[model samples]
Target: MGDDHWLDLDTSKYPFPNTLWHIKPPKEIAIKVTVMLIVGIIGIILNSIILHILIKNRWLWSPSNYLIGNLALVDLITLLLCPWFMLVRDFYQQYVLKHFGCYFEGFLQASLLLTSVGAVMLVSYDRLAAAGLTPDARVTKSAAIKLIVITWIASMLLSLPWITHREYVERQWADYLETFCAEDPKVLGIYWHFTLFILVWIPLGLMVVTYGAIMWRLEWSAKKLSSKGAGMAVSKAKTSAMRIAACVLITAVICRIPYTVLIYWRNRLSNEVNSVEGSFDAMWFAANYLIYMNCAVNPLIYGFTNRRFRKAMDRTPGIAWCKFGSWCCVYPVYKRKRILEVDKNTEKVFVIEGTPRPNRKLAHVIKNILHINKETLDFSVKIDEVTTKPTKITPLKI
Candidate 1:
């Protein structure tokens, strides 16, 4: 807050030299903060469940699943780290954005945001590959891993400008908090703007074209599938794929457009022919929340669009919230959650009959579960009654 010791809302740099910006009323600020708390918490829970399901089922580890897992990982990190700090800053009326918090938020945000968008794009591309657009007609597991590694590296590079320009300083206007996280606008502003363009616009364009092409291909393929049984299977897969693509595309656009537009609007405010100062603050508040809201809804998209995902979620969160009536009851079990396996010949049969021992830890539980990634395996835990056994036993890979 060297500029004025105000809460840093721009998410670009903190403690800027400009202290002339409008201030929000306490009531309005409180409302926005409340929404953030709710969304951030929900996002964390849902994304974690998604990650658990992805991790538990070893047979599910394909190229598509890898992208899905990467996505959940990024979103989980963002929901956990970014929103918590912002909520604290807003709720407490703190003028100081601590140095580490200020610098790290933008750094992590930029990297995670890029990784999220890149992942969605990867999923779209993989669908195209699966639909016979490429010679292999599938993304090899090795190639998918390489692509994921490349994405994280690229995000780190893209977000480098923020790290280099950040600073810790005393707030000029407020003495309540001695130091705040600030950015050196002169050093990083231009690069931030350029990278912002590449981050927001490039993905918007790609998603639009990629999803459109996928729809067209779906239509073309539907005609070639003439036999009823094979045609039905093709139809189901295509329909499910397109539904997911559409939902992801829509959620990303809806959440990102406002924030991107508002940032653009503020940057262009001086060039405006009319007075638009008052609404800018409100719009900025709304736009930022929109972005936050985007982080929260991927779980909803997955649950609604994919039946297997829905089933997997049902095995954890659904079981926790619906059957047990409280997440606290589900937490201990999910924390030590193990694999669920069924034999190829039998249906609805679980491999084990007792709950995981709380004292016995296994490093390979998540590893084996993820590697054995089968979506259709019955995860319904049924224990032998009147015996010293619990229903939810962690299964070893068969």
Candidate 2:
């Protein structure tokens, strides 16, 4: 078309306030986008449910669960950000973000992604450690948070090169000079290597090592226990746990392998042929999204594989309420905790005795699950929990 005719054609509907950078999406690509949006929403909602279960059931806050919670939190952040970037690229087709905006968002996103993978690895390691059945020190709840913090710091440190070379630049396209945020092509190789190593390889290695060892350990233990005439229940539980670990690790590997392979392929082709984007196709776009599926599907795996988690989810109100309902509860202020133990029906049950809940009515509502008779409980203050003050136990209501 001639320039004059092209200019005369409706240009008003093409720019910002008039349009939200809405390019008419092709049918096939549009379908993929719609499906992604639906899945992303479901993942976020389900993860939110997991968060609610974790919060309400204070008893579930063990070190391993803490890691799981952290993973969920990071994946939630990833799901939120991934679509945003996709929209920016798909709709605007330009970097609307200025220099600092680009840098900050990029850094935060990379760190969150790295932290999510790190959290998954930590969860696997915690499980492996737990299976040791040794009295040696175990990872504490606080330690899990500490490890996540370290991962965040490491992610930022590793992503620094991307930030340092980042620029908002204008490039000539078919008919326009498009602006976008990106690393300098000169430093792209560096960024790619760092991203592949830290974001993919290292985490995958740890997950494989940790979960693999757990699988081996559990198999050995099962054999030994069977020989010792141990009940099948204990062996079964370990088997289930091993299966859970394997599922998580394998799913992560499968989801990420394509993305990683594509990245490597792109780099190799760049060396032999040219920039991969020059030949960008639907497969490339699909591969880009493939790794993100891991984040979206992880909660499904947890819900499916773990019986207790499934039970709690079942007990939770409707799925919608459970996922996004935590905001409704005005949680009490964080306070130091002291655990107390009571001998009950041959099982040693532990109870969370924290500073009184802000809502006085619910303060004595037993927070931890324990099977015991109400009569034997000592309502009168017993031994001082942290101090010498006698502790008071409230009656368990029917």
Candidate 3:
């Protein structure tokens, strides 16, 4: 809101006019809203598909799979919460500020924020135990389920203040702005500690320690490779290890590190220190948004870097229905419904129909006949404008 004094951080007046709820231009606001909407839609769809796939393949219910699934679900919540953000940012720009909107936006933001932290920490542990310390150390399905449940509970508890403090307040200044879903400074201070402790500090420490240990073990293993007469095997193993390490490192550096630094810096600085409405605050806000983008980035990274994930994605029926974007891919979940995708550039639409029941013997016979991997046989139908629905045809069988 344009009520500069409303923010708990500082009392300094923002040189920007208070007549309008937001200082930004309408065009800029529109652009930001559009981008957030696009990203949110894509994120939800992709993560949904991934979750469905994991469900379809029971293997996806494994401990690692459960963690990934929870991550996707958290991302889904974050995406669903974007519209509130889009609305407030737009409303603020238009000089229309409502108490309810503020609370909604702030509450959703906190919920998603906490959930994201929990999800990432869960993922870090999953990777550490599953891939780093002992590749053979598999988490039981029940344990994984318990972990996800606990993550959700923690997220809910941590976000309670935001929900509790949603209210309409008038600043001493002539400006009357609604403060939706945000706690008072004192309450928020408590929350800040919890969030920083769980989300920032703990995860950073675990990632550094676990990844470091893994790298050390990998280096030691590489040394043994030469003496074991498995030079080529060792080289390949090392390469795989390096790739995983690189992925973790990049994710940590580009996503988590900056946000953590910013939080610490903001806390340490006096209210007046960073209260000026200038390029710095704008940059800081942009940086905060960029950190949020990390949630959407996970699937893209998984699709590109993980060969098996890519191959599986390609085989998914109705993938063509997803819009193709420069930075992201969109796809439909072919679970209970059979759908055909029609995509051209950024525009994508889907037509749904009844999915065929899997005939085990028939599927095996067809796979053998077609000389293709049975796992790749994701049965689907095609739809065209005139069809109004899916038009099923016998798939090619060897």
Candidate 4:
């Protein structure tokens, strides 16, 4: 097992020593790359919209929503940066970005993912407090900002191994150079296990406990309401809350658990196992797809599931236009008339006819008419009549 021993082997008959350099079938590559590109692009778009909505709406600037906004931000960055490297790796059958890319990509993905997990956990706890089960757990705006900052810092520090342990190694094959990003295998094992604990297990456990407590409290409240003959209303509310909680928990497990299992399985196998074998490769692609899908699905789960978020989304300008089209259009002008009695003593009726105008302009018009009348007597004015006449206008064609 000398450094050059691989060189002595017949290149035509032997495969590369590292599975990272093994190319998959072109068809497989095309399908996987295309699928990833779609998911990544969709995730980027969805997260961007979510982030924009959060930033634009002043009313949505609550502590819990700040955590949600942070989640969208993390998902946006992850979808934007990490996926390109992954797609490249998938297509090239090796780490093509060389040394700097190895460290940067790994660190970026790890930090963003951990940050997302932390935000989701915070959101769950925030919801628990909002449910009034743990009123003390409610956070102020300042405290929420602090928590976000701490989460990011912790994520980066925890992911520091990605920067330190990565090595971009190149080996000269018989006719071509084979390059792959290597990590300290022992460190990788420990790091991934730790990552799984933080990303999957801890969050999952917290969600179960947090949502469980909220549900229990809701059930108790429903029971109390049952005595008051409002049980049906409370029951419906409880069911809706349970449905949302179930969706959140189920999505987390579906998106994350497969990837965690894949990592665990890989780590359990011997180092020499071919990672690009058909079954394992398919599993890898499927697992990663689900992970990215999670990023896109977050806005739908957390945003649409929320009554306030749904209201805000409906109120968003362009969104209403998109949804209802011509129905959102407003009449720019309306034909209006007002009849006023200048004086009860004189029985003089003054009529004003015009399109609806601002109060100042209408007042100026009235002053002009009064000045023309040349009546200097102390006069009492009264709004004798007000009416709107419909005017025909062409409908805007979409």
TM-scores of the candidates in the order shown: 0.66, 0.68, 0.66, 0.74
What tens digits encode model 1's per-residue C-alpha lDDT throughout 65-132? 88877878888888777776555554443445676677777788788878877776787677667664
By summed lDDT, the worst window of 10 consecutive residues in model 1 runs over 376-385
Which TM-score value belongs to model 2? 0.68
lDDT of each: 0.64, 0.63, 0.58, 0.74
Tell me which of candidates 3 and 4 scores higher on lDDT: 4
Candidate 3 lDDT by residue in tens digits, 1-398: 12344466433344333344345667877877777767677777778777766655553345666777778877777777755565555344332446665555666666776777777777667656754565557567787788788877877777777657655554333343323333466677566677667766676677677677666766676787878765665576567666766776686567666666666555655555325345545555555566566777766554334433444445555652442232132222342133233322334233223434446797766755463332223323222112344243243422
Candidate 2: stretches off by over 4 Å: 1-29, 91-101, 171-175, 270-279, 317-398
Best-fitting candidate, scored by lDDT: 4
Off by over 4 Å in 1: 1-26, 88-95, 135-137, 169-187, 226-242, 270-277, 314-398
Q: Output the lDDT of residue 274, model 3.
A: 24
lDDT of 4 at 172: 63
Return the candidate ranking by lDDT, descending.
4, 1, 2, 3
Root mean square deviation (Cα) for candidate 3: 13.1
